[model samples]
Target: MIRAWKRFAAYVLISLAILVGMDMARADAGSTVAPAAGPGDAARSWAGHIAALRARA
Candidate 1:
């Protein structure tokens, strides 16, 4: 169904976004963007958020 496809697409997009964010965070490492706790850590948390969205869909 169209709805199923839409859900899958959304999941893929969210996964990609999180990956890109982590990469960017790593690229800026040690330049203040990385932060003491690391920037990509939040990206991992986004997986949970996106998982919820996918589940809802």
Candidate 2:
């Protein structure tokens, strides 16, 4: 009975470790395409525009 319990514990621990490793690997593998940060990004930032307008006033 003790032997069976030991084996069960080992299996559970190994399974958990494998799951954690897979999650870490998945996080490292970022999306294939990078997000678009094109030249007009700054131009489209409404908050910055508002701040500029406020500063001018």
Residue-level lDDT of model 2, residues 7-53, one tens digit each, is 99999999999766544443454323233487575344434445544
The CA root-mean-square deviation of candidate 2, after full C-alpha superposition on the true structure, stands at 16.9
Per-residue error (Å), model 2, residue 14: 0.4
After best superposition, candidate 1 residue 2: deviation in angstroms?
0.4
Q: Record all residue pairs in model 1 with backbone atoms less than 3 Å apart, i.e. clashing.
A: none
Q: Which tens-of-lDDT digit does each residue in 1-57 have in candidate 1?
A: 999999999999999998786555544442224323555776755554465445545
Clashing pairs in 2: none
Candidate 2: Cα lDDT at 27: 42
* Each model's backbone clash number: 0, 0
Cα misplacement distance, residue 31 of candidate 1 (Å) = 9.9
Best lDDT goes to which candidate? 1
TM-score of 1: 0.52
Root-mean-square deviation per candidate: 10.8, 16.9
